[model samples]
Target: MRPLNKGAKRQRVRRDPAPSRLFYRWQRIWLTPLYRRLISLGLPMAALVAGGHVLWSDPDVQAQVTASLVRARESVERRPEFQVQLIRLQDVPDDLATQIRQAANINLPISSFHLDLDEVKARIEEIDAVREVSLFLRAGGVLEVVIDQRIPVVIWRGAKQLEMLDAEGIRVGYLDHRTDRPDLPLLAGQGVGPHIGQALEILDAAHPVADRIRGLVRVGERRWDIVLDRGQRVMLPEDDAVRSVEHAMAMQMTQDVLSRDISVMDMRDARRSILRLSEAALEERRVQQAIAKDVDNNL
Candidate 1:
């Protein structure tokens, strides 16, 4: 083993010290521009080849692309904001869900791209009590739908089948409200629109007014008539029916007219009123009074 003596090493280096920087020894480095360019380009070229090998050589590229596409589709479909919700005047019944789904035509191709609001609204209105529809597109691709329902105010008890009509005389077709509606007045014959509408209006104006209306029947275009709930008929003269109805109402209140078992309240004469009771009804009333008298005499 040789001992390292600072003195010996200093004597060897004292004459001239080696260059402090390694590159300082290469005096001609800047002179070779071609070499510099090649050296600089070498690293990027290797990286480019390596990247190309990774991109093209792998058999899983197609699978990865397909997987990405599937994920994108699933992500869109599963998003909470994209879920569709619907409501009706009544919540849609599960039993009718199939019918509603069919009516919506969701799977139809062109339905997605094109919209016909007027047509859709018109179709929806065709339903028995549907009054309004609201539709909106959700952010994640879902659609929200809502419906408003109409209330029936009159009964169109025609010869064939009974239908529910609104104040405007619009038919609402067979419905579940028949039990409740039966308590309402029944329009026996055809051409009972404005009459029924007028009756409902008057009835709505004040409580018990509607209950007194009984029913309105259309006799030819020449005349109109109203039937009281008490099984009496009131003939209204042709023309100014509104005034006639109002007059009849006032006369009824003044006379306590409806309070009696009056047969009819004829407003046709314009100057006078007529009353007619059915023979059977009069007989029944007479019998009821006789029974009351007999009971009073015994007491």
Candidate 2:
């Protein structure tokens, strides 16, 4: 080996300015918009997932979290604004109001959040007299229940008992006796429930003989016979029963035919009216005819 002079300086080697292959590839990937977004969003989401998994792995921590949620919910639900302290019924009678309260079965000072309005409405509508009902939580902690009660227009005397029915033929309530609802028109016999509208119309047309009307009987499930006082019946046809009744009323008003000793006024034939006399009236009529015949022969 040759020895170098002490004054001579060693030359420095030059390095490349570009990055390595691995580092260059990583830089290109980092510059990509999708990659950058993934890194930005995925890290926090992974961290959150890991943290949640660890937190919920413990039973005590899970219970605490559930309790905290329940308390939060209860805090909002127990607010005074959400509490129901009273129940007010609208458009309901006192007797029915008592029954509706019993049906509601609600505890006072309860949270409105726990009350099921639909369920309460269903309960109240179970009553026979309730036609329709609506329920809502009003201001000032009042639970208002509005009710539409059925109005009874007629009394149906069934084979078993008497039932008060509305105009639609739906039962309002049951009555112990006919005298309980004397204001409403009485109806009897089979298949009258479905034809109550016609019966009502017939009764309306018989207003001239309203005082003598006892009831109406459904004959053969097709026709109606208006039963009047003194065993008198106005037999009406199946169709145009209102007109038939009107004709009978006109006869009663003009000729006082219904006031005679007639047992039945057969208005079944719209063309003509037939009067079936009572037994006594028939006997008297036969005696008069016999006397007339004997007088003619003598002449």
Candidate 3:
């Protein structure tokens, strides 16, 4: 080899110390606060959720979990504190209490959780005699049922049967005979249920003839006909019906008009009172008229 010049030196290759582009980008994202937190917390949660889903997907596991939960619930519900030993009725007669038990149809020694109080209450209130009802569990494992019985205010004689009704015209119970409730005023004829208030007012005004009055008959569902014991009736108009009754009572008080031999006192016309005489009275009037006519002709 030829001798090299001292001024010409050999050159060496140099390498970069920084990381690659992909590794640099990944490192930057990993250093971020949100990404670091997510990486730390999310991975365990995701793994846990996936494991749970896999385990629950097995039918055997699902059955075991369901059975465990049911057993737990039963244990809690079957405790003495949740047990209903018996049902007690408050403000209910013995007969009605029996009826209530029949209506409730609940077996004894049931869990209070299993006893649907609302459904029991609804069944109890279905009775015609029950105005309202309340149900609750007493401290001594007794299911208490409180009842408000419908009080009968009047006796209604329907076309085919007789029934007792409350003040609101709701049927309370059926009657075997009119003598069953002699205290309540008797109401008859169609559409009388809705007009019970008006009928009651008329009855109140007829207190003077209460003993002689039999019942009130609704005429054509528009007016009232007060029937008396001795085949007598006071026909009242639709408007001012109570006032018409008052007028009849007034006449009875002053003139003893109800005691006369009149079949019907027609107060339908407000201006005048027309009296339909009895058959006997009509015959007597005809005979008298004939005698008077004969005497006048002879004169």
Candidate 4:
């Protein structure tokens, strides 16, 4: 029943946090040494501004820039592909350049052959040509390459595949892409060539057939099936395939037996030749032998 107070007492006002003042104090502390040092040195702010420009504005950079450009130009000229300049590489001594100019000392009608872009690329890859390469104008006034001949790995028939391999069994290429250079032996079925140098050696040493074979395929794991230009398969055995191949090759030349349409001449048999006749040829020969036997009995 006593008089009730209706008005509320005033609330204390909240103060804002003085984070900026504290940060300023820290900033002053941190900067004190640097500012004092500058003041003691009597160094002017304008001097620092001038020194920065002097250190950064280097004229030597221009020389470095020019030298880099010169190296780039020289490198481009060095490549045989770009005809910008004939460099030290162009006049290679005792190389293909020398061989092509002198290789024909053994041959009569030929003195030198000119080299073209395509020929230049191919001849340089050869081992014996000294990788010698030279440029010459071809019949059509096109670029041609001349080089000393390489020792052929073997004679190749171009009708079958794309690459020509060397005697040691190094692959060149097929598709006649580079024709300015001379051709090498044709080889095929190089699927097993993943074994590298050894596989090629096997092909190189593979008897007389190695020389006469037109195409070769790696068969199974350890054998080879060689095809002659006459369209016959000469099956070389696993062991001493080289010598077995020699006997078969001798038979081909001596008996002239490869002239027949044959499917396979298996030299895999150690002692005898296993002949696989073409189906059509086999059928015809069977019929003729039967007729000859019947005629003989009647007589």
How do all models score by TM-score?
Answer: 0.51, 0.76, 0.80, 0.42
Model 1 worst lDDT window (10 residues): 106-115
* Residue pairs in clash, model 1: 203-210
Instruction: Compose the digit string of candidate 2's lDDT tens values, residues 12-123.
Output: 6777678989999988988998997777888789999999999999999999999999999999999999999999987678989999999999989999999999899999
Sort order, lDDT high to low: 2, 3, 1, 4
lDDT of 3 by residue, 1-299 (tens): 87677568756566767899999998888899898778778878899999999999999999999999999999999999999998988767887889889999999899998998889889988989998998888898998887889988888899788999888889998999999788989989888778888889999999988988899999898999999998999999999998988888888889998888899999999889888999999999999999999999999
Clashing pairs in 2: none
Listed per candidate, the RMSD to the true structure in angstroms reads: 14.3, 6.2, 8.7, 20.8
Distance from true location, Cα of 189 in model 3, Å: 2.0
The window of 10 residues in a row where model 3 has the poorest summed lDDT is: 6-15
**How many residue pairs clash in all the candidates, one count each?**
1, 0, 0, 14
Error of 3 at 90 (Å): 2.2
Sort by TM-score, top down from the best:
3, 2, 1, 4
> lDDT tens string, model 1, 50-165?
99888867779867878999888777665555444432323654534444455655543222334464565566656665666676664544455566655667787677677887
lDDT, candidate 2, equals 0.92
Point out where model 2 deviates above 4 Å. Answer: 1-44, 57-61, 280-299
Estimate candidate 1's RMSD in Å.
14.3
lDDT of 4: 0.57
Q: Model 1, which residues run further than 4 Å from truth?
A: 1-102, 105-122, 131-134, 176-178, 182-185, 194-196, 202-213, 221-223, 280-299
TM-score (C-alpha) between model 1 and the true structure:
0.51
